[model samples]
Target chain A: MNPLPRIPSPRNPAPLTIADLGEQGLLQRLQPFCAPGVVGDDGAVLQPSPGQALVVTTDTLVEGVHFSATTTPPEAVGWRSAAANLSDLAAMGALPLGLTVALALPSTCSVAWLEGLYQGLAQCVGDYGTAIVGGDLCRAPHLVVSITALGEVPPPLVLKRNAAQVGDAIVVTGYHGASRAGLELLLDPDRALTGLCPPSPQQRDQWIRAHQYPRPRLDWVPWLRSALAQGQSASASRSFAAMDSSDGLADAVLQLCRASGVGAHLVQADLPLPPGLASWQGLATALDWTLYGGEDFELVLCLPETVLAGLEAASGAGVPAFGLRRVGTIVAGSQVTLHGSDPQEPGRVLSLDRGFQHFSELF
Target chain B: MNPLPRIPSPRNPAPLTIADLGEQGLLQRLQPFCAPGVVGDDGAVLQPSPGQALVVTTDTLVEGVHFSATTTPPEAVGWRSAAANLSDLAAMGALPLGLTVALALPSTCSVAWLEGLYQGLAQCVGDYGTAIVGGDLCRAPHLVVSITALGEVPPPLVLKRNAAQVGDAIVVTGYHGASRAGLELLLDPDRALTGLCPPSPQQRDQWIRAHQYPRPRLDWVPWLRSALAQGQSASASRSFAAMDSSDGLADAVLQLCRASGVGAHLVQADLPLPPGLASWQGLATALDWTLYGGEDFELVLCLPETVLAGLEAASGAGVPAFGLRRVGTIVAGSQVTLHGSDPQEPGRVLSLDRGFQHFSELF
Candidate 1:
C-alpha cells in the first residue's frame, strides 16, 4: 500500500482544529447580542415578570407535508410559517415581540434556498417589528421550518378561549372558502367549471396570493383592546372575548361555545363566499368549504350585540374590510345548529362540521 | 357499473370535522406552563436585566444525519438534542434556565412515539431545572429536533473567549479521547485492540456509557465560580477565560488562542488519554482522533498559574475532580504548537491551527 502515503501533520507546537474555529466563531458573533437573564449558566435563564401574561404559540411547516417542493416557493414557505405563528398572537390580543426559528434541510439543499428562506423570515419580522433573536439549523432528509412566537399581554386586555358567553354575536374576518377553492384549482388543474371554467390571470393571482401569503392582522389587537376598554356594556365587551378562527368557522364557533359552556345556532345564508362561486350547487359547495377548510388564518370574534356599531365603524375606516357578518348566536347547551333561509325548514340547513386535524386525513 | 361511490356532494353540510379544532386545543394544553414574553403576539417579549448577560445557543438533530433510525431510540434522540444545547450553555459558563424545542415528524408517526420523545425531554428538563415552556410540532418526511437554550451570567463571573493572556495555563475538566474511542468501537465493533481492552462487561459498560450519556458538568459551575472568585492573583481571578471543548482538544485550543489573539504550546506527553488507549502507535492513531473528535462536551479553562494550587486543593476534596493537566501556556502570537519528546523530529511538534469543521467526512 506504499507505506500508507505518510500522512502529513501540522509542524507547529500548538493544538487547534476546524471544530474549534466554528464554535468560537459562533460565540464571537453572538456575544454582543447577549442580554441578562436570557443566557443562563445551565441553560436559558428566565426571570419571572408578574402581572403581565405571556402568550405563546408555535407552528411548523414541512416540505411535502405542508408545502410542496415543486410548487410552493421557499420565500412563501418562510412567510407563511411566521404568519401562522403571528396569527395566534393576534387572536390572543397580544403584542408580538421575538421569535426563535428552527430549520432543517437536506445536505444537498442549496445555500441560496436557505438564504431565501431567511430573507422571507427577516422581511416578516421587520414588517411586524420583531427580532430574530435565536434559532437552530441542522442537516436533515427534507426541509422543515418551526417557529415559536412569544408575546406579552397586559392583564386587562388579554383575550382568551374560555370567555365567550351566551347571546354573543359571532363575527368572522374576511371572506371564506377562497383558499379552499384555490387549493382545488391548483390540485386539479384540468378540471372544468361551468360558470368560471378558468380564472383570468388576475383572478388566479388573487386566489394564489391569498393561498400563499396570508397576512396576520396584528393591527386588529389595538382596536379590539380599545373597544373592550370602553366598557360600554356587558354585551359589547363580551363580543371581543375570543379572537381565533384559523381552523374553520364551524369548528371555531364550537370551540367558543365549549369554552363558555354554551352552544350556538349559525345562519348558513350569512357566510360570505366568493361572488363567482355562488351558483346553486357551487354555493352549497362553497359553504361546505367555508365551514371546514383550513389555513384561512382569519379572526373569529365573539362579541356582545352592542359592539356591532364599533365593528361597523372600524370596517368603514378600512381595517382590511373583513366581511363582519353575523353568522351565529351563542345559546345554552352543548351542540351547534345551522339555519337556512327558511326558518321553518330546519331540514334544509346543512351542517359542515368536519374541521382540520393535524395528523388525520380529515384535514 | 358500480354506482360511483356518491362522492359526498359539495353542497351537503358535513358535521364538524376534526380539522376545525384549529390551534385552540394546543393552546389550551400549553396555556398553563407557558411563560409570558416567551409566547404569543408578534414575537416573544424579553425583559432584560442589569449586571447580567444572556447566552443563547442552538442545536439541531436529524433522524438519519445525526442518528440512525434503527439504532437510536426516539427518547434517546430527544434526550440527545437537549443535551447538545445544554452542553453549549455549559461551555459558556452560563446558568441554564429554559429551552424551546421544535419537533418535525412524519404524518404517519405514532402518537406514542411523540409522547415518548416528550417524556424524555421532560425528564431532561426536570433534571436541569428548566422548563419546556414552548415549541412547535409539524409533519415532515423524517424526525427533526431543534433546540435553543437560553442562559444567564452575572457580569463579574461571565467567562468569555478573548480573556486568555500570555502564560495562562491550560486546564481541562474530565477525561478526553474516550468519546472518540467509544465511537470507534460503535462504528466498527469487530476492530480488536491488542491491549487496554476491557475484560469485563462492567468495564465495557463504563466505556460505552461515557459516549451515550456524557453529562454536562452543571453542578461544577458554582464550585468553579467560587474558586475563581478569590482572585488575589491574575490566574486566580481569571480561573476560566474560555470554555467548550466539544469539537476536541486541538480544535478548542486553536479557538482559545485565536480569540485571545495569542499562541499556545501543548506537551504531547501531558495528554490524558484513557487507560486502555495508550500505545505509541495507538497514541499516534488516536492522537488525531482525540484532537479532532467532536461531542466531547467538556469545559476547558485558561487560568493563572497561581490558582493551580487552589484548584488542586479543591479537586482533592471530592469535588468531582477534573483530570487537570498543564497542557500548554499562552504566548503573545497567534499560533498553536505541540512539543514532541524529540526536538529534531520537525513535524512531530504539531500545531492545531484550525477549529473543527462540522459536517466534514472525518466526523
Candidate 2:
C-alpha cells in the first residue's frame, strides 16, 4: 500500500455538504439529543416495558411533492415529518419510545440547513418525551426525509382500525379541517403576511401553525383506553377501533368503516368545525374543508355509548377529559351516509369522497 | 350536504399512477407478505422475546445515486435496501423481527415495477425468518426507499463497535473486495455478456451476484457470542467488539479503532482477498480493492486469541463457523499502521484514506 495524502479539513464557515461532515461527524453532532441507550452504533437498543407490545410506523416526505423549499422552512419540514409518524402512534394509543430518520440530501445543500432540521426534530421529540436515536444519510438529486417512530402499548389495550362494532358511537378529539385551511393559506399566491385575508393576524398564525407544526394528540390516549376498558365491562361493544384523521374526517371515517366491515350515519350538524370557519364566506366551503381536507392529526374513535357517558361524566368532574363530539354511529352496512336531516331519507354517500391523494395533483 | 356527481374511474389498461392505486390499495397489494401480528392498522405491533432487547436501524436508498434504474432492476434495489439494514443487525448479533419501508415514488412509476420491488423484498424477508410488518407510501419526483428494521438480542450479549481492547485479534468473515469488484463489473460500460474480461463466466457472475445480492452473515452470530463468553471465562480477555464491513476493510477497521480508543497493526499479506481477484491483472490492485472498497456486508470482529481458537475448533467439528482470517491486532496507539513487512520501517497510515464518500465525485 502506498501512503495517501491527508486532505485539509473544511471549517464550519467553509462551503459545506454532508460529504464533508461524513457519517461519523454527522452522528457526533446528533449524539447530544439521543437517548441513553442510543450510542453511536449500528442499531439503537431499546427495552420495551413489561407486557407492552412495540408499535412501529413510518412516513416519508419529499422535497417538491410534500413541501416547497421556497415556502417551507427547513425546521418546519423536519418538525412536520416527525409529527406525521408520531400521529400514527397516537392513533394506536401507544407511548412513543423514540424515532429514527433517514435523510437523502442534495449535494448543494448547506450544513446550516441540516443543523436547522435536527434542531427542529429535536424540539419535537423532546416535547413528546421521545428521542431521535439513529438514522442513515445519503446524497441524492433532491431532499427526502423518511421517519420511523417506535412506541409501546399494553397488549390488551392495543387499538386497531378493524375493531369497530355495530351501533358504536363515533367520536373525534379536536376540531377538523384546520390543517387543510392552513395549507390553503400557506399555498395561496396572493397572501402576503398581512394581505388578502379576512382572518386576523392571530387567526392566520393559528392556521399556518396548525399546518406546519401540527401536534400529535397523544395526551388523550390514556383517557381513551380507560374509557374503553370500562365500556367493555358495562356494554357489549365487543371491540374498539380508532385512527388518526390525517386524510380528512370523511375519508378517515370511511376507512375505519371499510376496515371494520361496518357503515356509519354521520350527522352534518354534529361535526366539529374550526372556529375560524366563521370568517369564510359560505358554510358549504367550510363543510367541504372539514370533510375533505387532510393532515389534521386528530384521533377518531368508535366507542360504546357507555364509554361516551363515562367520558362526559369525567368532563363534568373537571378531569380535563378530551372534548369529543358524537359525530356518527357505526351501523350494519357497507356505505357511510352523511345525513343533513331525516335519518329515514336516503342521505348522501360519503364513502366515495376522496381526501388529499398524493401523486394526483402535486406530481 | 348535496349529492356529488360520480366521476368515471380509470380502467386497468388506462395509464395508472400511484394516485389511482391510493394508499390503501397499495397497502393491500403489500399485505400478503406481512407477518401475522402486523394488522393493517396505524402501526405494526410486535412482541419482543423474553430477556431480549429491541434493536432498530434504518437505511435510505435514492434513485440516480444509490442505484441506477438503467443498470439495476427494481427488485435488486429493494432486496439490497433491506439487506443493508439487516446487515446492521447481523453486526449486533440480533435476530430480525420485522421491517418497515417508507417509499416515495414518481407519478409515472409503473405498477409492475412496484410489484417487482415487493417481490424481491418479500423474498429477502422470508429467507431471513422475518416479515414485512408495515410501511407508508407517498409521491416524489424520484424514487426513494427508506427501510427501518427491528431486531432482538439479549442485552448482555449485544455486540458493539466500542468494545475492542488492546491485544484483541482482528478477524473477518468471508472474502473482502468481492462486492467492490462486482460493482465495477456492473458499472463497466463495455461489458457485454462475455466481453473484455479475463475471468471465466463463473467468476464474472460471482462478482456481479455478490454486488447485487449480498446477504447478511447472521448464521455465525450465535457462534461468535458463545465464543466470546468462553474466551472471557478461559482466557480473561477484557472485551469484544464487532461491526459490519459495509464501508470496506480499511475504513471499518479505523472506525472500530476510533470507537475503542485504540489503533491497529495490520499485516498487508494476512488480509483475505477474494478468490476471483486472482483472475485480475495485478495483486496491488486487488489489495487496494480489498482495503478501500465498501459495501461488502461482512462481519469484522475484534476478538481475543482464545475466542478465535474456539471458533477454529468449531469449524473443525463441522459446525458452520464463519471463514475467519486473522489480519491484525489492536494496539495502544492512535494511528492505524498497515505494514507490508518490517514493522520498524515506515508503514502506510490507513486512517487518512476515505471510503465511498457520497457526493465526492458524483455531484
Candidate 3:
C-alpha cells in the first residue's frame, strides 16, 4: 500500500502543494482561521478600546535560522512565531487584540504543512483571546513567517524598560535554561548540553516542548499589575520596569540596565535549573544555558522590594507557578554582575552582557 | 580609491555589513528613521484617534521575487514595499497612520544598502503623513521586507470590494501598465517591449521610475470621497466600491465582481497609452500590458454615473492628474467581459480573470 502524507493537513484535502491551490484557494482555506468577516478585504478594520493606547509588535521566524524544518513540526513553528510577538506585547503590559501574519514560502511547500502552521497559529492566537485579523502570502526561497500583533494598554499602566529604578528587585517568570536545554536536546539527542546526563523521556519531551512552543507570559500581566499597585500603596514613589527574556537573561538584564541607566546583580542562589538535573556535579553548564540560551519567552521584570513581598503575600509564600523568583537587584552601575554564579570560586563575580548577537555569532 | 563602498552608508559610519553591526547597532542606526520614541522597547505604543476604525494591512517583498538586487536600488525596494501596503490603506479610504517593518536579511547585506532602504522607507512614509513605528531584524538566506501598516477611517466611509453595484461606472486612478513597460525596459533596455519600437530616453526613464517607485495614490481619497458623497446626494442609495490594482486591473475587477456577485464590461476605446506608444500600429501590445501586467499600485473604483459627472464638473471636465477614465461598467452577470478589447477583431469580446498566481509561475 502507498504511504500517506506524513503531516496532517486534512483541511487542504484536495490540493497537495501550495501552488496547486493557488492564491484564492489558499486564502479561502485561511479565512476560517482568522477573525470572522475580517478577511477578504483591502485591510482589516479594528476598533481600539476607549481610552487605551495601541501596542504594536512584529517578529519573523526563518526556516533554518529560527527553526529547523527537520526537527521542528510546522505547527510548533507557527506557535513560536506568534508567541514571540505576543511575548513582546505582554512585556509592555498590553492585552492582545489581533495580529497580521505574512508568510513567504517556497513554491514547492506542501499544502498540509501550511495548514498545520495555520492551525498552530490559530490555536495560539485564540488561546491568547485574540484572532488573526489579516495576512499576506508570497513566494520566496526560504519560509519566512512574519507576525505583527496589535494590543491595547491603558496609558497610565504602560510598562517600559526605561522605568526601572535603582534599589528595585529584578525577578523573572518561569525557569530559565529549560528552553535552551530543550533545544540542544532536540538538535542532537546523543550530544545534549555538556555535563548533562541524558534526561528521562518525559523530561526530554517537556524540555523540547518548552523550546518548540514556549508560552508567552501574558497571564502574569494581571498579577504583576496587582502586585505593583499594592507595592505602590506601600511606597508612594517608584518606577517598575519589564521586558521579555527572548534574547537570553543576560541580554534582557543588560538592555534594562542600558535603557534605565542602572546595573543588575544576579543572585545565583535564587536561580533554579529544571528538575532532574540534580545528578550533575556543579552548576557550570546550567548557568551558561540560563544566562545565554535565548528564546526563553519569559518576563524579566524590575520592581521595588515592596512588590516582591506583595507577590508572596498574594500567593501562599511559595508564589506558585508564575515561576516567581528574585534573581537580582537593580544597582547604580550599567553592567550585569553575577554573584556566586561561578562554581569554581565561591562568591565569584563575573561581569556579562550582550549575549547572542545575531550576525556576529552562529547562534 | 575603494569607490567609497559603492553606496553611501554615512550614518552606519564604520559598519561594513549587517553582521558587523549586529542587531542592537543596526536598530540604533534605524531608530532615527522611525517615529520618535517608539524603538528600544518590547513594542511600540500608538494612540488611535477617537471614533475612528483602524485599517490594518501587511505585505511582503522578497529579494528575487519582488525586485532584482543588482538592477533595483535599495531605496526603491524600500519605497515600493511601503507603497504596496499604503496603497491598500488608501483603497479602503483610510488615512495613513504608521507602519511596522520586519526585515529578514542575509548576513552579507551591506549597511549602506540597508541605510538607503530606510531613507526611502522614511521618505515614503513621511510623504504620506506617517512614520515607521516599529520593526524587527533577523537573519535569512535572502532579503524579505514585510511591512504592516495601520490607518484609520470613519466606519461610515469605509470602502470595500463587496460594495460594487449594478450600473456603476468603473474608473481607475492614474495610468496603468506604465510600470509594466518600465520593468520590461529595465530588465532589458535594447529588447524593450515586444512588437514595438524602442521608447525615447525620457519615456524609458519615466516608465522605469514608475515600476521602481510606484507611488501609492493616497492623494485621491479626498477627491473620491467628495465625489462619492456628491453622487450619494444625487441618488441617495448606491454602493461605491474600491480596491488597489496591485494584481492588475483585470484581477481587481474580478475580485470586486466576485465579492459583490456582479460582473463588469470594459469599454476599450477609453484607455489611452503613453504619448510615445502612439507610434505603434494597433493596441495589441499596450492592451496586453494594460489587461494583465500587474503591480501597477493604482486604484480601481466603482462609482455611480452621477459621481462620474460630479468628478468632471468638479475638475473642469478634465479631472486633471487624477486620471479619471470610466473604462468599464458593472453588470448583472458574473464575468468580466472586455468589449472591443481584442485588436484582432472589431467589437470582439474576451473574458478574463485570475491574472497571476505567485507560487505557480514566475511573477
Candidate No. with top lDDT: 3
TM-score-based ranking: 2, 3, 1
- The top-ranked prediction according to DockQ is 3
Which sections of candidate 2 miss by over 4 Å? Answer: A1-16, A36-39, A189-197, A235-237, A312-322, A360-363, B1-20, B36-39, B189-197, B232-239, B314-322, B359-363
Cα deviation at B337, candidate 3, in Å, is 0.7
Error of 1 at A97 (Å): 3.0
Clashes of 2: 0
- Give the distance in Å from residue A58's predicted Cα in candidate 2 to where it truly belongs: 0.5
Between 2 and 3, whose lDDT is larger? 3
lDDT of 1 by residue, A57-89 (tens): 667788887888668665677677778888888
**DockQ preference between candidates 1 and 2, better one:** 2
For every candidate structure, what is the RMSD over all alpha carbons to the true structure, in angstroms?
11.8, 8.3, 4.6
DockQ values per model: 0.19, 0.54, 0.70
> Could you give candidate 3's per-residue lDDT for residues A154-199 as a string of tens digits?
7766889998988888988887787888887877787544454657
Off by over 4 Å in 3: A1-15, A190-198, A227-239, A278-282, A310-323, A341-354, B1-15, B191-198, B227-239, B278-282, B308-320, B341-354
